[model samples]
Target: MDSPWMKRSRRALELRDGFPRLMAVLNKRKNFQTIPSEVSSST
Candidate 1:
């Protein structure tokens, strides 16, 4: 069985790893939406 401390640390590590990936996805989505709107407005 895993210790509580180990489990907590593992969860924290997962969050640390996942947070950036989540941010990147959100940033990419924002960029995707903005780019199309800008292109449409320009033309």
Candidate 2:
């Protein structure tokens, strides 16, 4: 018999695996937004 808790825990593990990649993409987007302004100011 399949347990609901087991299914939930499996889903949680999948989310944990993917969360870092998601954060990296978000951080890249944040850096992309800031870099242009910094370059413009420096030039």
Which prediction has the highest TM-score against the true structure? Answer: 1
- Model 1, 1-43: lDDT tens digits are 9999998899788868777885676588788764445324532
- lDDT tens readout by residue for model 2, 1-43: 7699998888678768877985686578788774445423632
Local distance difference test values of all predictions, in order: 0.69, 0.68
Local distance difference test, candidate 1? 0.69
RMSD of each: 12.3, 12.5
Candidate 2 regions exceeding 4 Å error are 25-43
Error of model 1, residue 42, in angstroms: 43
Sum up the clashes in candidate 1: 0
